[model samples]
Target: MPEIVGESLAKRLIAWGVDTVFGLPGDGINGLMEGFRRHADQLNFVLVHHEEAAAFMAVGYAKATGKLGVCAATSGPGAIHLLNGLYDAKLDHVPVLAITGMQETSLLGSRYQQEVHLDRLYEDVAEYNLMITNPQQMPGVVDLAIRNALIKRTVSHLTFPNDIQIAAVDEDPYAHPAPGTKPVSLPNLDRPQLAPGEPELRAAAEVLNAAAKPVILVGAGALHARDEVIAVAEKLGAPVVKTLPGKAVVPDDHPVTTGGLGLLGTKPSEEAMEECDTLLMVGTSFPYGKYLPDPGTARVVQIDADPTLIGLRLPVEAPITADAKKGLQGLLPLLRGGDSGFLDKYHKEMESWRADMKALQDESRDPIAPQYVVGVLDELAADDAIMTCDSGTIATWSARHWTIRDRRQYFLSGNLATMAPGLPYAIGMQHAFPGRQVIAYVGDGGFAMLMADFLTAVRHDLPVKVIINNNNSYGQILWEQIVLGYPEYAVRHRQPEADFSTWARGCGAYGVKVTKPGEVRGAISDALAHPGPALVDIDVNPNEPPMPGKVKYEQAKHFTEAFLKGQPHKAATLATVVRDKINELRS
Candidate 1:
């Protein structure tokens, strides 16, 4: 029987456990589209409004499930559009496979209409990038790309020419053997784990055991090592501070969770970092060196799989090169508990910080404080909800207030920190787990950027809920200008405010707008209860600023001067902040 190369490629991918692919159709790749049609029974293709969204959906899928996510695009412009999302996967260390089409082999050097130098374009972003030139190389190359992505935890790219995709091939890569033939052998795909040696673990333990006040900083790499991380923390009586990407590793409600530490983090975590004598960093290369204690002020002991990342962000005294889970297991046996007095002090501070957050949530305001909206969302969300957040000021609210309990999955654009990923991430999550609840917490600026895809969800019948914090501005950028002593310009959305509920309904989905503080909970409940895709546009206060963990005197002076220069209308917001600070002090 005759076989097409694209068909063999698709079958090999299915064998490697890829069930779904996100992409758009274009004229450059009629061959790959034909393969999709022929293999429709085995594989599902999710159509997206834009190729960029398709790539982000793949990233979201990879992040949600620790497996290889697949995305496809046509030649030239279509492939270029996928760079932003692919970089998101690259920086965050998620496994993703990108398949793109190319111009026909016959048009090699003729400068065809839609040709692109895809190999060079994807060079930096992909760990494995290649163009399939031979029909016989079909199944083998596909297998190699998948393996490389999974093992390296990076992006892999494979470009197939339009002519070669449908070219005839003879042998099936998975053909049955003859009577006397030997059994076929395949590469083992099991994950590799490395544990630190005795001396290395002992060295790390000795460093931690001597310190008076030690703290644990966790990152995305330590996600699966939650138990081990907590064990080490408990053994040392140290506080566990999660990085932005590590928030879900340990729930905020955990007794030792100090939330996150940085610009978008909690005060308790900043305090822990400032006061600790030793910083035991677990599977994280947190980028903000300034937020951490000075080199001599705190000794650093870092554990990571990659040796190069050991002291990338800070000085290290003990470097243990191993997987987070295995490294922690090796060190746990040699560690001794530090002073309980240090743990007691941080615990009380954490409690006070949480109480202050709750008080802010309870305080009602005219435009509906976003903090209250997030607090209510924490209460109403399902136990296993998958929450996807857009990058911006809304990220601050999500980090500060969203309580991740019941092992709920929280995903964002982590290192790349791109906008317009929230909706696509939620869509991908819903497609991956049809029964589970998915929520996209988006801000006004970000939601408008990709609202075109709201129709994609509706068309696919995905019951994803979207909560829009409609502050009508790029709130984070405005705050940055304020804190940097620069006047705000070109940051606010000059257009009139959009009623997102009306827009959602126009796109054939359920939509509601909540303007009052009292109506926030009911609106969210109703949106969740809707049978199809729903959007809840809440008019959160635009004047509310995102408070960082540490505020310097210069930043305060800049903020005050900026407010006096052009933001005098925000005096009421300043008053509200002062009142909240006084209340926090009294508490």
Candidate 2:
């Protein structure tokens, strides 16, 4: 039995459906790069200025195509640089293979240059981490990483020690071939239901039967039984209100669907959730618990895929452990249809909320409405286009305002909330889904954080159109300073004139700049028309506010600082926002 080493790893990479790899080839890992060069016919290598962007690009690709993404880096600093994006992948559950080179196997513990314990460092952030110590373990390790990335739906890692790459080995590709894809369904477990379950279920139905205001809170879990979820909502004459992760669970324009609810959510969703006494949270978990009004005072029922979640965060008067689809189906027959009063009350509130939301477009005066820009993008994007949004206020914008429906896809780093990640991910997505349009919306601040990678798109001719929201500052942080009673520190940046279009032309691609609201549609048209990579840079209004949230200003400022200052997993900031998301649709 023979085995492969460095070049063989590259071959196995292609066998596992990896079409591209992003990373820099440094002194410690030139052998893998050489292997990649020989197999250039089957694989493409994207070069970026930093390893962080490479990891982010991989994340975007997975989000868009529903396939495993691959990113690599040299030893030491290069591998360390990937931690930021690695954490991002872990939190979002994006499948990624983060490969890195290591020092000579003999030198690993000798404090040699570029030598570090790669496996231990990556353990917490990766679903599985491995150090390829032998050529015999080559293909098996490679296959395992890919399977973990896809099956666990998480970040997986592999490290190649310098000595092993140059060591003598065999060349059997079948030592381990790629595995099959995993099922999308979450696991069903056996757990006990609360005592008041059946009674509470009927009581919740009574509220649904009796109330004039009823809104259904749809979470990401709805993806499993979309048809059943829609059927249940329509049968009860309830409007669907979603959480951030559940943006696309229900159609945005569905007469029975309200948009996302959060800091960047719309008044319609807020009014429906906050004012409605009878709230049904089904198939998802809303982390912002504090935002949810006390269930004890209101009629609250929870239907979760996992039984543990039934009463995990807040005590659900009604907790159903069955699949949301199964539970909803079971409960519907027992529900007696109610009068028009509750539905009419919710409808009235939704109408007023819709009017207030509509007024945002009326800010058609200069600087351009960021809200409308997002709206127009939603309208112009192809039916199947995959959109990736950066973290921060722009993330809120997409979650709250983007016209995502049951069929559309909108990817966000909702759990990790990293900036400057959307562009790189867009490039990877374009490679994975060559036929589908891939669009990325990034704030000026976030874009600059990884600006150089725009060239990576040009080099590969990955025709991704980027919408740069040029607000000239850290817009969200600035608002926090004002509201939180802190002087604006590090929030403002010099209004730099970044001629992305000119740069695109220089880079052998396309670029368009729009300064007003009217120009957005035409620019988007021009971008979609262009043959290759292009960017639509729009000067957005910094004052365009988010939908709504309960985070205090001062706390928000410190939270942003913790992220920008390199403190990953700082609980104090994220803890506040992680409250059980109360999808108490006012409707």
TM-score of each: 0.94, 0.80
Q: Which tens-of-lDDT digit does each residue in 55-86 have in candidate 2?
A: 88888777666667788899889999998888
| Runs with alpha carbons beyond 4 Å of true place in candidate 2 | 1-3, 11-16, 34-41, 168-215, 275-283, 298-312, 316-344, 405-407, 495-497, 547-587
Q: Per-residue lDDT tens digits of candidate 1, residues 1-587?
A: 35787787778777877888999888766777777778888888998988889999899888888878889999999999889999999999888999999988889779999889798899999999999776777676777788788777889999988888888755334464312221112333424476788888988889999989989999998988989988888889899999988888888888878889999998889988999999999878988898888878889999998787899988898999888999999999899877777877888888988888877775467778888899899889998988999999899999988987877879999989999899998988898888988999999888887788888999999999999999888889988988887767777776678899998999899999888898999999998888899999999888778978667788899988887787744676687687667656765
Evaluate residue 317 in candidate 1 and report its C-alpha lDDT on the 0 to 100 scale. 87
Give Cα-based local distance difference scores for all models.
0.86, 0.71
Best by lDDT: 1
Clashes of 1: 0
lDDT of prediction 2: 0.71
TM-score, cand. 1 vs. native: 0.94
Model 1 worst lDDT window (10 residues): 177-186
